[model samples]
Target: MTLTQHAAPPEPPAVAAESVPGPARRRPPRRGPGLLLRPVFLGVVALVMLVPLYVLVVNAFKSQQEILTDPFGLPDGGPTFQYLDRVFHNAQFDIMRGYAVTILFVVCVNVLSVVLAGPAAYVIARSTRRRYRALMVFFLAGTFIPSQVLVIPVVYVLKVLGLMGTVRGFVLFETVLTLPFSIFLYAGYIATIPRELDQAAAVDGAGRVRTFWQIVFPLMRPVVATMVILNTFSVWNDFVNPQIILGPGSGLYTVTTGVYAAVSQFSTDYTVVFPTLLLAIAPLLVFFVFMQRHIISGLTAGSTRG
Candidate 1:
């Protein structure tokens, strides 16, 4: 009978509850519903944000009659590009020139901003001097002031310099308008990086310029991408600045100002204007979508690290 010798009670499995050094507790299984809520919430939010966009897209392809008759509905006649044609072909607004000026203006502003701010931010971040605080305050204060307040002064200065309504003027003004914020962003982000990197670069033959270009600049990619997106959007869609600087009926109109050309005191061309607005925003939307991944990291970089 004993030949079926009690197999020694199976030694407790290595990670058995009783074998655990402390009171053993099991984690509740993550609930599927709770896990699913985030995507569901985001999807709902995305749909909500897209309602206006849906209206624009639907109305852009339709006629004035369709827009008035079924404002909330999709295009009855499919996408009609006549409005686009009219918007671009209108004699009052030089749409092609506007596009050219806009591209040039955006490029120059981004170039000047990155080139100037990169070094300035590096210096400000790495500086130990007490006066740097004042400098930082000066730059960041520009962000708080409404641009309208400076309109008269900006116009006067540009007028004196013979830069008014010129692409050069737009580039200079946009760069100045944006620099403070760009420097502020770059400075905050650069501070999080350790000095060890700079030192390592210095230990080699790398000087300040080389160190910054080779070592520091590469790490600033996320922040730079963020700046590029922001500066491009601001310069591209600028209405008030272009209006004030370029003056009435200026050939230097951008896509934004071109949209304004569609409006009059007595009536507005909703069909053409709406399509033009869509065209104006299309580049911004596409850029944001493509660069969306970099945005989160870039925005957070200043607060993270060290």
Candidate 2:
């Protein structure tokens, strides 16, 4: 043996514990001026958005004297319910009734639009034919047509059908006005659903109607919730339609019309008018508070898909 016997196999290179695969390396902490600006920016936005609402509520509770003398001051005198009382008693109960009518109109429009548009949307989404695409475009185009332009023709047709000045007539018009947008939204959302779901249902011997009701309709709940919130808000707040179609004497007045009427009657009385305006908006505020989560969820979900 050539006494060159490997020098004891050179004690295997010492394995340093720290050099072994230990926990992952941590990234250095981020530092920048932008990080400090985020909260400040959000606070500014929040303050900007809250100013008008704060003024509305504060002014609503103040007396006409207080409003004129110190528009921005907190009530120096004890807050009085006089304005609300006047709104309730002197406004001919129209405010209350108008709220009822608005609720009815919103519910009717929401149901009718969803029921009618859902199927149409489903068909457009599933159909491969060029005609369906054309129809979808036609529906979307209708939204661009001003309601003012159509008012004359709509009134003429309603008069011929003896539906003018009637709540039913208003409901019908709202349904028609909202339908195009509803169908467009639903169709866009439905397009994102996998066709295999429908096919799978079909393979199980489910017919079109069954497949739609059991499978597709349930999936559309989020979009439907969003549409209901949007449509209800629009129809409830609409002024021009009810003002023109319902006419002055008709009891078919909605909250918007009633508030306008109150404004006309109490033009000089800030106490009366402001309270009435507050009352008119209260329902919408309450509704938004309760349904905001659903509306946001629905919109976000729909956007991700379609």
Candidate 3:
């Protein structure tokens, strides 16, 4: 009979409704002085770099009156193409012609330099002999010598050879000036490439010329592209060399010299000067835009290989 009060079936084991541990608290968004300062630093840097380009573009569109009145302001109305028109029509025609000559110079120099330097670089990289090493060091040391320092000597030599004032003369000078660096860069890159590739080619009956042209040359496209772009820009923009060697009214002015001549002659004539400047820069801009991918690729290739 038990005074067993029917214990109510122990309340169903207390169901725990909540998780044993509360939900993880998200970390407070990190805030530090660096985070605040970074954007400001970047903005300042961007502003500093952009100011000159902004001024150039704006001044190109402005009349002399506008430029003098408000050097830093936006155009009073819409931008005008008058300066551009004048430049295209008259101010820079000769300069544009010079640009064409520069293009020719660049192409020739790049092709010749690459052809000569490629083999030299390959040999220097693969050779273990002390004599070849000494030669490589000599070649590299030449790069430290300033071209300007040699100008007088070069002119004298060219004069002796009766090659002055000729395109061929300029080509020869540039080739010599540019070759050392090209060879150095190529050698560094070639050193990183496995010699086994060359050995394999030779084993398969590929001659040196054939192996280089078919195998090595293809692999070097990025470096070649970089060399072309660099040499092209240098040759195109070269003012002092062309100015001194080509002389005035030689009809052989490069764009840089042409623009300089325009500026000197016109002085404050913005209509002429702006357009000339614009035209002078236009080719470089176009080239950079078009070849940017290749340039970037070449840079990456050289960096990684070296």
Candidate 4:
């Protein structure tokens, strides 16, 4: 009975032939040149960028003789604050006044740009009308026209409007210049937001403007931040527009113009040139350090979403 009941011993499961260890697979050799290339290229690029900054910083603390003798060298003695102090107190160009005036212009331009561009972008983003699309094209067209080209025409227009050489005129013109790109950025970003949010807000008795400001505008902070930083840089660093628009005759000097005024007279005076230049850029450098992440994220998010 036991012999009858005993089944043939179960056969072992067949092993996959591929599972048998083959010759050790060889990995492709990494190219030594390719491996070293990226870091080497980056190092070269870094050197190129950092050399000027290094010179600017080193020379700022050194005297005229030290700068000329060894522009690239570290200060032999301890760094001095005298040059910076002189830059601050320069009677010919008040650095504090220049900062105040430039800051004011930056604030005015940002506020005006946001106020004007926000709603216009909302309409352009939501509208199906051909006219709205045409309006968008018009704004896009403005971005292609160089700000330098617009300077002469803008000056003429400002003069006709009795606003030339005035702070109001300068602020207004800068705001106008910002609108095209601001709207373009804003509209693209706004299109990425869900329309259901707008409908929900409307159902709650909110008007289009209210919905946009309260609901949509809050979501647009990233793009808006990107725009604010860009505009700040543009307005802050603009030498040509301010130099011409807020001419010396007007007694209004932005940081850049004041730098020109202080440094132009003493072009070869490293003591004056380096220090003033350093002071002028210090705030912006600090700002960029903090805001650089926002700039990259905002631009990338908008671009990716669009």
Candidate 5:
């Protein structure tokens, strides 16, 4: 009893006032200067980025003499359409044929990729099976593997398929290459949608295919827009894919490859160079401008998981 009682002197009566856990103190809202300066900083960044484009447009009209003399300066005289006309009508390069091929490339890749990816994604997002999950993971893994890395194997395959020089062949390659990214996007977006909708559709006697089209597909609009804009931009502007798949000399060359082939034609003529560059980039710029709103809305709309 004595040995037990001597122990520890009651440990200071077991202090009862230990600090209680509570909500973290919030940092004070950042004050005036930081908030005020953010927009100004962004504006400056935007201006800096636009400078190159400004240079391109301004010099695009200047005479070759003007370009050589004062390339950075504003247009010295009236905006000339001479080089623009040349870029458009130069039968030597067949600019419109390039445009047609490029448009076809974009349309085929964008439309087919989305159509094929959408169903694959829905299956991935809804299925409880491990294989579906594994398949989805397999697709996402593709984003990390650059197309450049597969050029040798792909070329061999294309040669085997006799698609090496043909437009359809290029389309086939582009579509296969495009699918993984498209599926990655669609699957992520569709996962955020409620399962209840699918269940409700099923209860209404809708089959899986019908449910996807009538119920799930419309809900996929945002991702579809995002897919179109992103894929179109990528495939349209891609120089490397076209360069390898369709050679620079190939008549089936897209705008990028065609324009590059024309580089030697101009022979470092800056006035022509500027306008040709402008011609090459105008479609992308126009596409971005028109879809800028849809693009923004679509990207933002699916960020939340519900």
Candidate 6:
């Protein structure tokens, strides 16, 4: 009874529009120009930054005559440790002691800055009252005032507190200098975190202090790391503040002050100048190279939600 009713050959399956192969879709123009542009720009920047560093390192091992003749060239008779050793043993400036003292200052300032700034920022960020807002504005105002301008007044204040030329005085002032921006950064970052976490901690019978440190502060690592890099560089390279505050009389020379002490007497001596300069910057350069990724990531994250 099939009656020769073979079903009409099943209609050919409809061709997918994609399979129909309309004129080949033009691929988005390969972003050739943009791809080339970024690497070119970065190369130029790196070249500019590296040139002086190159000159400094090359000349560091060279004699004054060699440096004067060919400052950019490699050492004529191989790199010398003579200058480096001299730097280590120089009677006027003990590089090792300078390292120890500077590290101590760095540690103290960072600790104090974090300790004071963290709690203050937590309070400022959480509060909504008019005075707390005013307080924030007040802190922000400090950033506009140059540290250079504050040097004299700071001297007077420190003197009154019997802290001038003292390590405590320098560290405390540096810590204060750091607070404004730290709080600003912390508040902005904290704004991005949900209040629900704080409430949850409170529900668990945790006080505000415990809540911030235990729950929220750990979350602030990126912003905190950013602040650390900034403060470390500031305190490390600060010639004027340490010069004026700690003073030569105090004999508390940071790397920069020690460099100035060593070099000021031998301004024309290339061996001393170049080697001392190299030593002064070497540790920081290595640190920055290693932490460059962290610096970029932290700043990027801080900027995003802030």
lDDT of 2: 0.87
196-304 per-residue lDDT for model 5 (tens digits):
9988988989998898878888988987888788888888888887888888556576777877777768767886678878888888899899887877777767786
What are the Cα lDDT values of the candidates?
Answer: 0.82, 0.87, 0.81, 0.93, 0.83, 0.89
Residues 138-178, candidate 4, lDDT per residue (tens digit)?
Answer: 99999998899999999999899988889999999899999
Per-residue lDDT, model 1, residue 11, is 70
lDDT of 2 by residue, 120-227 (tens): 999998999999999999999998998878888999999999999998888899899988989998898888888999999999999988988899999999889989
Q: For residues 181-274, what per-residue lDDT tens digits would candidate 6 score against the true structure?
A: 9998888788778899999999999999999999999989988988888898999899999999989899789999999999989999989999
Cα RMSD for candidates in order: 5.0, 4.1, 4.5, 3.7, 10.8, 3.7
- Two-way TM-score contest, 3 vs 6, winner: 6
User: Candidate 6, after superposition: displacement of residue 207 in Å?
Assistant: 0.6
* Ranking of all candidate structures by their lDDT, best first: 4, 6, 2, 5, 1, 3
lDDT of 5 at 291: 87
State each candidate's clash count: 0, 0, 0, 0, 0, 0
lDDT accuracy of residue 100 in candidate 6? 89
TM-score of 4: 0.90
* Pick by lDDT: 5 or 6, better one: 6
Predicted candidate 6: what Cα RMSD to the true structure? 3.7
Better of 2 and 6 by TM-score: 6
Residue 5, candidate 6: C-alpha displacement in angstroms: 17
Off by over 4 Å in 6: 1-26, 30-38, 303-306
Candidate 3 Cα deviation (angstroms), residue 194: 1.6
TM-score of each: 0.82, 0.86, 0.83, 0.90, 0.84, 0.89
